[model samples]
Target: MEKKIKPCIDNEQILKQRFLALRDTLDLLSGKWRFCILLNLHYHQKLRFKDFFEVSEGISPKVLTSELATLEAHQLIQKKVEYTPTKDITYYVLTTHAQEIWTVLNTLIEFGLSNRQEVIRSFHSDKN
Candidate 1:
């Protein structure tokens, strides 16, 4: 049996609120390196400034600095400095405030994979 899909409706205020929320999310993660940095920190737990360059090729020091600053400002990540005996190291880690983003990130991952399949299919169809 085929299932029926319900049509959803929202009031003006609700639409505005939803738009603002999405805008805020995009503002926080909008950048070439923001999502990549988030992904790395999620998997690695913590990472030093220099470590980003290793995982993300073709990224410059300036861009990384800018992206890190934005993430820090938005409270998506925290920066910690460690000083041992001879050297000081700075690490970037996720903050509790931004923990909610993990759910959004997972949704994005699924959307990305599904979109990739569609793109590949379209490309193959175009070639035929």
Candidate 2:
């Protein structure tokens, strides 16, 4: 006996909504350094502009400033300024909303690890 599966009545509309949602998410997260910056914040909790530049190797001060502004504008990260006798220091910290991205980041890390292993294996096989 063959079993029949029923599809949702609003399948097309649901698919469209999901597609748009994914597109929006990608647009928000798109860029070479966004994820890297987010990951550093996730692990470090907070970082200053100079700290990011030092840790993110290869990222220029201008690009880091731009990316930090974008993240702050999106509400994914918050910028804090401390006034001191010596100078004002600024730091960036991830928002609670940004915690949701850990799940996505973990999934990406897993996929990347698996893909890297596969690529290495393929390269070795090709060498044979």
Candidate 3:
């Protein structure tokens, strides 16, 4: 059996506000690298600029820098700078705010797994 997902706030008058909330969530999670970055932080906990290469291939430094900035602006991740004896190291870590997103990601994983075959079939048929 499949689990049914429902909105937490189901009041009629607040539907407009709920849609606005959804838009805000999408704005933060919209870009290519933000979701990937969040998932990376979820697993790895802390990452340096160089570490993103392992997170996702073909992420250029310019794009990574921009995505990191957006994520930080939304409080999804934190940018930390560390000074060692000889060098300054920068790292990114998931913020407490990301815990809720982590739950959503896990739920999405399950949904994808359950729906993969039908989704693939639908895509293939659409191209025919």
Give the number of the best model, judged by TM-score.
Answer: 2
What lDDT does candidate 2 reach at residue 37? Answer: 96
Give TM-scores for every candidate, taking all chains together and pairing residue i with residue i. Answer: 0.82, 0.86, 0.80
Candidate 3's displacement at residue 2, Å, is 38
Per-residue CA lDDT of candidate 2, range 26-107, in tens? Answer: 9989999999999999999999988997779999989999999999999999999999999998899999999999999999
The local lDDT score (0 to 100) that residue 100 gets in candidate 2 is 97
- Pairs with steric clashes in candidate 1: none
- Candidate 1 residue spans exceeding 4 A from truth: 1-10, 125-128
Model 3, stretches more than 4 Å misplaced? Answer: 1-12, 119-128
Lowest-scoring 10 consecutive residues by lDDT in candidate 3? Answer: 4-13
TM-score of 2: 0.86
* Consecutive 10-residue window with the lowest summed lDDT within model 2: 4-13
Q: Which stretches of candidate 2 lie over 4 Å from their true place?
A: 1-10, 83-86
Worst 10 residues of 1 by lDDT: 4-13
Candidates 1 and 3, the one with greater TM-score: 1
lDDT of 1 by residue, 27-85 (tens): 77887789989888898989998888888888999999999999999898999989999
